[model samples]
Target: MKKMFKLQWLSVLMLAFVLVGCGAKEDTNKETVSKEDQQVEKTSYKVKDDRGVEVEFNAVPKTIVSLQPSNTEILFALGVGDKIVGATEFDTYPEEAKKIERVSSSTTFDSERILALKPDVVIAYTTGGDDENLNALKVLEDAGIKVFAIKSATSFDDVYGDIQQVASVMGIEDKGEKLNEDIKAKIAEVQAKVKDVKAKNVYLEISPKPDIYTTGSGTFQQEILNAANVKNVFADLKSWPKVSEEDVIAKNPEVILTTVNYTENPAAEILARDGWNSITAIQNKAVYFIDPDISNRPGPRIGEAVELIAKAVYPELFK
Candidate 1:
């Protein structure tokens, strides 16, 4: 009777082992199917950029070269940092960007260096690429490398489109959509915080006194100032207009904001401007400095820039 009981116990153990083995096989099969589905989901199509250049893709790119810092920022934001083989010297965000090879910066692009990298796609922009050497992009195109020109954005909506363009080329439009929504949400949050406050006339000094340069209506800096409920004293002007001290004094801006970092202390320098004792901004000590990257670099951090400007304009509301 004892021997029969032992045999029954062994049979139960064998059945349990078989059930566990079947469960493990089921999980393995599910993983294989998931991978197969992912492979099957990828599709290819034609895309045209701001420059009217079209490129066809067979699949997602393996390597990329970004000449524009804003475009580079967008590429990394969309989870394509691993694919970026080269970027400009100014591409300093996400911390991982500094690890990539520098192929372009300011007004320079190295064709030989870019050729050595053999990137599948290259991102350039009209505002930054409008130079004699920019034709080097054609040399890369002749060699079967795809080139896409990012648009010269004058407003925040244009920036959203820029992100979508990069995301689509990388086959990640959903990520772009999600990112733009987040940006829009953050902008709306800043707007709500300062919506009821009185708008202040602001003078945006992009350069030092004497040869002072400032942004006007059709620029990203002006859009941010407007969102913060601050009026640009140069709104009637267009592009980066050079303003005379006489005209600025006549307009009499309440707040003086500078993005110029070439000097050690921009606000202090503003305070020491010649013949400005009666001006409201200098008199009330409303001179503030903004980081050029936050205001000038058009990318995913624009909402942060807008918020920073808003705080500078109305610290009481933000605080």
Candidate 2:
């Protein structure tokens, strides 16, 4: 009987694609882990978070505080979101997130509100170890809060590891294993679709013109493009670098994808770039928008990012 429930929940973990990255993380939802799984064995558990923040859990965390959306997504997917007593203002995916107490933001964290909640654990993110991130961790740790810092993630596998970390802390390893299996299955499905397709040259823009920031190697967008059988034009660059329009024209990308959503028409705005009409993407009208949330969130919806790119770069394959 125990084996059967374990198998069932393992499958449940896969079906839920709610992963989160809490840095600019400045960042969703899915089925919960269920109340029945909330019961934890009264045993000591110790593990290190991504940042090497060693955490010891004497018992399951009863009141968890998520400082970013990615941690929030991971917790929910592990079937332990109900334990969340506080989340950042940016946490929104499963709709139920909106109803939770808003406790932090991209620029500032309200230590007072967090302390008020008396969370058993506070999961946070360190985006390249900025001053704010360091201070936030210090403030909470100094206050006797068991804060665990999840390092800034760069790929999908990291997200999976993160889910396991959170689930382990919550004492739900079966659900975590199942969730990893599910995510891998979805990724395989995405890859299968693009296996034989010819790769297209792609350029991903997180922000619009003037300060166009594009990802190079070691970024999630590059992986999505790779999975979708598309090549990134800026793969030669490292990290998120500000790119010049002249270089983009030289790259001759066949498809242009942007996460920028400020303008009324995202595609049209890309099409209107002054010197970009000569680019292959503009000439063929292939400029498209991918929800920044899906591509950049570092959670379960990563498979959705691959699917969307596959369809955009090679519509025929999906059709």
Candidate 3:
């Protein structure tokens, strides 16, 4: 009977060892899972927008809404176009943005439609004041949606920052850097070609006719003019300024670049202006019409805008 008891004890001891081994294996697996969870938790998405507002995301946004056309262009350039579920009525680039649901207009925001769309994030813009749109966006923010507002860009660096901000929000910072580099390289190439060429005095007309408007210093258009090795005749002025025809004719710019597209033929209209026969640009037929969409937007296509301006100003050199 004592021998039998010893054998049973040995069997029990082996079973206890097996159970302990299994428990240790199970505990190791739990530890492995815990580490993986911790690693995922460590991955974070955060960006400070041009407004200096810190935006955080729980994960890469699956649905995005771009309130500005420039933001739409940047998102498409970043290859996150599919994620854009909503955009402004003015977003007409990439041909696909037009198909997206329009949630806002130049002067109106459809908060109800945007809320119904249930976007993961909304990309907005501000002109550095108490924007009424911010009040509308606040509703989205209260609804647990992320709103990132980018300030209006006044320089190429600002444009780059805007791109990086959008990219960071989309979790694609590498692509944003590459896009900015590509733009810089293209601009550099054009700059090198024009470095030896004499800089031309230019009058860039943002609007034409009775009331004329042009960009001056402290504006992105001025930067584009600078990159093209051209001088804005209105650079002495700050921001966008309304100038009289008398002032423009007096400036007598060597090249007149107009981004006025509301009319059928902006160049023709400029040429037909009364009492403007003495202007050098009109005399030399140097009034070139720039695509307002491209030139005006502070987005990925700014390089193209610079090249267009350069080509218009110095056709011989670019060719």
Candidate 4:
């Protein structure tokens, strides 16, 4: 009987050992399968920018080169400040972006210098690729660098949308969505107060010096004016056309808008111009100064620009 009991105990021990081994094998298989699945499921998307450019990355780029100050501001806002390996001159706003390597000088890009840094992505403007500066993009592409061409922002939506768009390209889609919603709400609130108000013809002056440039039909500044329900006097002029004082007098502009960065106040200087005093905007003292940093930069601050203009152009509408 004792011998029989020992045999039964040994058999039970063997069965228990077999079960434990099978369970361990099954767990190991599951872990291996999980790792394989993760490898297969990982994916990323390529975005085609304004210049008909295609750029690819590993879902989220670890290093970036910002070619424009506006783009730099957008990247910082998107919480990807650490990703930026280099930035352009005058990327001073927000204070922190200034610390990055200055790869571009005065809106001009240097591909050779940039390529040496081994950045994962490059963000630039089509306008920055003008006659004075060769589009440094081709060299970077030939060297296997990723270039993300940011389009010139015109309207309020473009400002907000581009922020989200860049975030998406950088694989921070959630942050982009939140940013877009916030700007949209802010814009809608501003628009709600200004809607149904009578529109005025506005002449947006770039400068009041030897030559004057004004925002026209195709310019982004014109879109901002339209958003505020102000009719641009040079709306018929194509793409930031030059105008004379006589033109302003003939147009009979009800309002004048210009960059605030000028040495002299644009409103006061324009009123002092030879023929500009005859303009209705001057006669009514409707000329106003707007901060060029906010007004001109085609970035996230455009909503603030709209509000600034709305208040200056139609103070009664806000109240």
Cα error of candidate 3 at position 44, Å: 4.2
Please provide, for model 1 over 1-319, each residue's C-alpha lDDT reduced to its tens digit, 9 standing for 90 to 100: 1110011111221111110000000001111112431321234555677656666666667899987677777888787787899987777887999998987645457777777888888876653334333465677787778887665666787788888787767666668889999999999999999999889999988877668888788777888998888999999999778889888888899999988777889999988988887889999999999987777777888899899899988989976
Residue lDDT tens for model 4, 1-319: 1110011111211111110000000001111112431211113456566555555555457788987777787888777777888986667767888789887765245666788888878876553234222244666777898877655555555666677668656665557667767766766788888888889888887766677777688656776787788888888888767787778789998988877364666677777777667778889888888877677777766677778888889998777
Report the C-alpha lDDT of model 2 over 13-101, residue by residue, as the tens digit.
11122223322110011123447654345446676765555677676688999876877877887767888989876678767778889
Model 4 CA RMSD to the hidden true structure, in angstroms: 21.9
Segments in model 1 whose C-alpha atoms lie over 4 Å from true places: 1-43, 127-134
TM-score for all models, in order of appearance = 0.84, 0.85, 0.85, 0.77
lDDT for each residue of candidate 3 in 69-106, tens digit (9 for 90 to 100): 88888898888888999886778898998899887655
Q: Which model, 1 or 3, shows the larger TM-score? A: 3
Question: What local distance difference test score does each model get?
Answer: 0.73, 0.72, 0.75, 0.66
Model 2, poorest ten-residue lDDT window? 1-10
Q: Looking at model 4, report the run of 10 residues with the lowest lDDT sum.
A: 18-27
Off by over 4 Å in 4: 1-45, 51-53, 127-135, 155-161, 317-319
Instruction: Rank candidates, lDDT, best first.
Output: 3, 1, 2, 4
